[model samples]
Structure formats: structure tokens, C-alpha cells
Target: MNILLKSSVLCASILLAACNSDDQQQSQTSSQTITESKYYQTKTPYQPQQDLNKYEAIPQGFQPVFTELVARHGSRGLSSIKYDLALYNLWKQAKAENALTPLGEKLGADLESMMKANILLGYGVEGIRQFGYGNETMSGIQEHRGIADRLLQRLPDLFKTASTQSASILVQSSGVDRAVDSAKFFTAELIQQHPQLKANITPMSYTSLASSSVPTVEDGGVDRFKLYFHSLNKEQDLATPLSASQQAIYDASQAYQKFEEDDAELINKLNELAKNTQAEQIAMRVLNPLFKPEFIKKLGTTGYIFSNTGSYTVTAPNGESITEKGKGKNSIASAVDAAAYVYELYSISGGMKTELKGIDFDQYMPLDAAKFYAEFNDANDFYSKGPSFTESKNVTSAIAQGLKQDLFKQVDAIVDKQQSHRAVLRFAHAEIIIPLATSLELHNMMQPLPLRQTYNYSNSAWRGEIVSPMAANLQWDIYQNTQGTTLVKMFYNEKETLFKSSCNYARYSSNSFYYDYLKLKQCYQIQ
Candidate 1:
């Protein structure tokens, strides 16, 4: 099959499976299909996208040998109190002016309720807990616990061997509380689910495991390309050009803004028409009400640089002309900040029952808005944490190299005779998973966000919702037969995934999601 064709089919399945029946039903009945709109919601606190039962069965008679996973920390509360405080101030101002819609009026009480809940959760007024901001929620704990149980069920032979041979399960995480907490919950549940394995399990927080927070590029550990990846985070003002994919998303966002501002009635009409006729504007319409008009425009302005690429001269206050590179449309911290606040409210509202009487604010803030933010956030990440077609080709390659090093390092340890390890679990933030997926060239991560077209389902392969949602994970299961033929099957966020086409393994066809271990090692140059 053609790479694009195969990619489309696989990506469609993965994305669709990420949604449950309600999401599916909403997609079908709402203004746009998930593909046509292709919005990504960042940290919107959603459940697992893929149904574990629907996962493809392991190929017949392939008993597991070594297994490992790199996972993003599970769903968590907002990273800071800033977003909440910002919106709360806005809500207060809006209330003072009586500018809030009736639904908006309910927000004042809701905000108070959310504040109290956070206080009770030990966040205090500063949103600081013992673990710090953005720590995992209880739901986050259950997420890893559930994932642990499922993995035990999926690879019975691996856990069985660990029990029989007294093999140890090595658990490592970034020192960050969320990542550390994720590793803790996962192992605890793994042990609780299968108590026999507890004696052999050893968990630790390895600074090296948290590559996302500190890529350690300064140590001269990363190669030339890896250095480029490290530079992206600092070269915020670098004139990084956008690809065709990036351009498309930018254009669509522009169009959405244009329609939103100049022809509001038209957008409304289109949305109304979409509701009845399944028109594309329906998704846009659904998302339009989530924000006040001013904030939406602000977000649009902040997001512009990601779509269109170039540098312009800015006149300093001292009347000197300074040629500054355009890192993105908005400053790094401000880009999608509004979306972040909106998502924070969404999560906060989950705890507000009594205070939310007259309004269904969550419905007003549909998944479409989250998807739009997700797309925007992914664009920001594309430069900072993901591979893309940059003016400098080396950016993504650097991070990919770093992650490949970590992957092979773990793989070598797992396969080492002295270790006798059944599993290796490494937990970190979305930063690690995104770049690692790009390095691995799995599914949507393989395609660069284009420069000229909107990154809807049809044009681009990347979908942040499935690729790096909270609790997202990538797993590699090594299997060997009695004849000692070892093979590897990879899974991204629980869905079976194929290696990049360039690294076609001898054991599996291009369409096959499995690969020979030796071929994979050679393809990745995993020494």
C-alpha cells in the first residue's frame, strides 16, 4: 500500500478508537467528523482513547521475552494557579460589568467552588501541594493502575516468567512528582494486581529517565542532530520556517478567525446549517461559544506564528531597529494560554456540582475547542519537543537521537542476561513521548505538520489527542519462540503500530505492525 494511504487508514483507526461511543456519536451528529476538523485538545483530562479489548491479539505462539514502555504521566490538574487566577480575575471583572451571559454568571460561584476544592486538595491558595503544581489527580492514579492491570493480562507469559524465575521489574521515572507518582501508582497496582511479583520489583527515580525536562544536551552526549533538537527550545527567536502541513493549519485557523470576526452571522449560519446538514462549520460553531470574543482573538493572534513562518524587524522603544526572529506567532508562554485556562476550568468544573446549576458549561466548552487547542499546542510542541520539517533539518534528529539512546539503553539492560528483568518502565512528561514517537516515526508522528494547508484529518497524520494525551504510552514487547527467533511488536497509546517505512524489517511486511528484533536494532542502529 502507498505510505500515505496506509498512514491514512492506520491513523484513522487509531484516532477513531481514541474516542468512545459518546465522542463518536457526538462527532457523527455534530458539525464535523474527527478527521475533517482534526483539532487537538491539550491536557483536557480525557479517558483512554483505545479500547483494550479491541487491540489485536499477539501473533500465534509468540511468547513474550522482554517488555518495556515509555509513558507520559497520567491526567492531572492544571500545572499552575496562574491560569485559574487569571480567569477568575476576568470572571470577577465580567461580573462587575454584568457582561457575563447567564451561563457566565454561574461561573463566579463555580470559580469559588473550584478554589475551595483545590484548597481542600492541599493546593492551598498558591496551587502548591506536597508534590508541586500539575501533579497527578486521583483519576491519574487509577489510569496507571488500570494500565498496569491490563498489561499484566496482555502479556501473561512475561509476568509468569518474572514470578517463576524471580525476575525483577525495573521502574524508573523523572524526578518530577507527576512522573514519579505515575511510576509509583503503576508499580503499586502492578504488584497489587499480581502480588507474586512484588518481591522482585524495584522502583527508583533516575534523573536520566526524565530526558524531557533535561535532555542533557550540554553534556555532549547527543549527536549533531540531537544538538539541533536541544537548540529549538532555546532558539525561540530563530526563524524556523513552517512546512506545508503547518501552513494549512495556520490558514484554517486564520479562516476561522476571519469568519469569527468579520462575518459572525455567516459562521453562525454555517454552524446552524452544519447541525442539520452535517456541514463542516458545525464543529467551529460548537467551539465558538467556549470563549469570550476577546480571548478567542487573543489566542488566534498568539497562534499565528506557528502556521506562517518568517522574521520581521521590530523597532525597540529606544527607536533602534532590531531584527528579531519569529519563533511563533505569540511569545512561548502566552501561546494558547487562553486555551490552557479554558481547559483548567473544564477540569475544575468536574468538581463543581452544587455551584453549577443553571448552566451546562462543559457542554458549551465542547471537545472541539479542546481539539483546536490541542492542534495549537501541538504546533508549539512541534518546534520545542517534536520532529518536523524545520529550516534546520537537524532539530528533530537531535531529540530522536537522544531518545533512541535512552530506548536502546533500556532495551540492552532488559535483554542482558545478568539483569534477568521481565519489564522496564520509564515514566516522564509528554515531552519525552512526543519526541520519542517522532524518532520512532510511528503513525501520525511520521508526517510533518505542513506549512500551507489546514492540518485536518485528511492532510496530516499527527493527532495530539492520541499521540500524547495524559497517560499516553508507547510499548515494545519482545517475543521469542522456542527456536530462539526474537521479534518485536510496538504499541503507541495501546494501539499496535508499525515502524517507519524507511526501517522496513525483514520479518514483517511494510503493512505489518511487528518487526524482527535484529532488524529493528540494525535499523535504529541500536548497538
Candidate 2:
């Protein structure tokens, strides 16, 4: 059977790394289908994309031997209070001056409630008593917990064998509170759902490749350096481009640096959108409930920015911990800032649907305007992290090198019999996941757009929601036959997916997903 003929083209709702298409008609139709689902609401929060009971079967003789996964942290509240407070401060000004519309009248209380919700996001979630800004919400906890449970279902024999045979399953985290919290929720739920496996679950580290410890990014460890490779945070020294290789990969690369600085295009686009007649009309249409036209007009000329000086942490009497956030210098300046700020809140509110009740941020955000921002944000990310400029080659390729190396390192150990660990689970943020997704089929999703075209919904199939939503993940399960041939299969966001088309499947498997382990390594150009 010709595997290509049987492949069903998935829509944007299910963006998997795909097989090559020789059928131009199919590719054209598939692109049209995916592009239609790509508009608006790009910050889609977590929901499993794959059907649980419909996984493709492995080759008849292959038995699962090892598994590995790298997952983005589950849904979480706003990272900091700056955006919340900035909008709140603006609301205060509107309230004091009687500039609030009837709809806007309800915002003051809603903003306060939103702040409180973030402060308590993960509190009491699976025994976690205290969580604050940038921490997981109950939705987040359940996301990871459910993912772990599903994994057990996917590879029951391997997990069962590990439980009875004393094999290891290593877990690691990026050390940021949200990512670490995700790791905790995942492993805890794994043990809860299948108590027998607790004996084999361990925290992985480089030293002696030990079992039974959860090493954080703060441990000054190489594992963290690999998984948390994105240089997003500079404050706690979490992940930076200070290292020579990272610097070369990120800092010195001009194309990457332009992306780093957003190609200096983000602010201009925001400003342009703010001035557009249709956007202005829609802004008024959506925010009419919140602010008076005169006040909105006055806001058109004002300007301010939020800034953070520093922060600290606090420990509760019972050992619960929360970050003691310092007052950020926050304010809403002009009409543009107000719209952008509300969009920020609106964007975040999507993640808090399970947490915040009784208040809706939607009343302040117009879908058209929200989409304008989402597209720009998506473009920003596309250039910065996703399948970026192929002409430069080094841009996206270099950013994901560390993650690729780590995946190979763990799997190679299993293949070489140098490690007893049956699984390796990594918890990280979306920035890390995006690059990995692109690399999974760099020749496809990462392929450059046609000449003179730029990244946008209609022109590109990549959507942040499909590729790097909260709790996004990629997994690999390896199986071996009695005759000593090992084969591997990949799952993107828990969906069975083919490897790059250049990497053919096992000839004996009737065009199955399984790839011969050694040939698979060669296909990826991994030495």
C-alpha cells in the first residue's frame, strides 16, 4: 500500500509534523483547510488535540522499551502584576474623572478580582497550598495530570514492566515556578493514577545519572541548560545567552538579533493599528461599555509605561511559598496603550477561564482588534522562535540545537544500554516547545514562505495555538523486536505522527509509523 495515498491531511485544529506530499492537489486543499482555522484567538489555551482511543497500532512484533517527552508548562496566570496593575491604574483614572462608560463602571471590581485570582492560581491544587504570579492555575495542574495519566494508557506494558522490574523514569524541570510546578503536578498524578510506578519515577541529573531526585534549573545543571535553552528571562539568571555558544547562536546572529528586537516592527504596527479608522471604530464598539468617547479621545494623546525594579519571595508558616511582588511602576498612557493593555488582559483571561468567574474580559476586546494583535504577536514569535528565515538557516536551527541534543542524548543512552531509565520527562515553557516543533519536520512546517510573502494566517499554516499552546508536547516511544531491531514512533501533542518524509518507515510494518532506530538517527543527521 502507498502510505502517502492513505494519509489524511489534518486541519489547523491538528497541526502535526507531516509526511511529504507528492500530490499537489492534496497539498493545496490541505493548506486551504488549515489556513481557514488560523485566524483570530491565537493564544488558544490547553485542550488535548488527539483522540485518546484512536492511536495507530505499533508493528506486530515490536514491544515498547523506552519513552520520552518534552512538554510546555500547562496553563498559568499572568506572569507578573505589571499588566494587571497598569490597566487597573487606567481604570482608576477613568473612574475618578467620571470618564467610565456604564460597561466600564464594572471594570474596577473586575480588575481587583482578576488580581486576586492570579495570587491564588494554584493554591490548594493537589496539595500545593500557595502559588502566585507566573504559577500554574487549577486548569494547569489538571492539564499535566491528565497528560501523565494518558501516557500510562498509551504505553501500559512499558510502564507496568518498569513498575515490577525497578526500571527508572526520569523527570526534570526548567526551575521557573510554573514549569517546576507543572513537573510536580505531572509526576504526582502519575504516581496517584498508577501507584505501583512510584518506585521507578526519579529526578534526573548528570551525576551518576541518579534516580529519585527532582533537579531544578537552579541546581546549575547541564540538563537545565539544555531544556531551558531559551534566553527569555534575565532577572534570576534563569536562562541567558551569556554562554559563548548561546551567545553565538542567539546574540551574534544578526537575523536572530533583529528578531530579538522584534525587527523593530512591533511598536509601529501597534501604533498603526491604533490609528486605523476601522480599528478605532471597533475599539469604540467593544469598549463602548467601558469608557466614554470623550475620555477615549483624551486617552489618544496620553502616554505611559509599566516598569519593574526588583522582587522578593515569602514563605508561609506552613511552608507554602509565594513570590513577594514589589509594586511595579505601572500606568496607562494613551489610547494605543489602553487597547494593547486590555488586549493583554484579554489574552491572559483565556488562560484563566477555569479560575476567574463572574467577570468577562471579552466585553473589552473586539475580535478584529484582538486578531490584529494576535497576528502581529504570532509574526513576532514566528521570526523569533518558530520556523524562522530559512535563508539565514542558523536562526531557528541554532535556537533549538540544545533541545535536539538532549533528546538524542537520552534516547541514545537507552539504545546503547548505558541507561536503565525507561522514560525522560521534561517540563518547560512555550518558547522551548515552538522551536522543537519546527525542528521535528524542519523541511515542512519550518519551510520558508514564497518570495515576497511574510508570516500571517493566510500565508502560513503555523498557528501558536496549534504548535505551542499551553501544555504542548512531543513524545517518542521506542520498541524492539526479539531479533534485535529497534524502531521508534513520535507523538506530537499526543497524536501519532510520521517522521520527516525522507525518513521512511519499516518495510515489514505495512507502512506503519515505526522507524528503524539507527536509520531514524541518520535521517536527522545526528551522529
lDDT agreement with native, every candidate: 0.51, 0.63
Model 2 ranges with Cα > 4 A deviation: 1-43, 124-130, 204-214, 217-222, 232-282, 300-331, 449-451, 504-511
Alpha carbon lDDT at 110, candidate 1: 61
lDDT by residue for model 1 (283-378), tens: 334324533555333433433212112333434345655442322322212223333454546643442333233434465456655443344444
Best by TM-score: 2
> What does the lDDT read for residue 281 in candidate 2?
47
Model 1, position 390, has a per-residue lDDT of: 35
Q: What's the C-alpha lDDT at position 362 in model 1?
A: 68
In candidate 2 the C-alpha lDDT for residue 223 amounts to 47
The digit string of per-residue lDDT tens for model 2 on 1-527 reads 00000001111112222223433432453354335432223345676656779777777787999899999888778777766666676677678889887778888887777777876666555434345677777777788889999998888888887787554777777766667667777877777877777777664232121223335544532244456666633453434446655544444334444555664443342233223334344345556668887777776453423333233334544686655464765444455556666777777787687778857887777666666556556655665577755544646546677677668777788677786778888888786788777777632455654324456555565657667777888898888888878788887777666666677643335456577878778778886
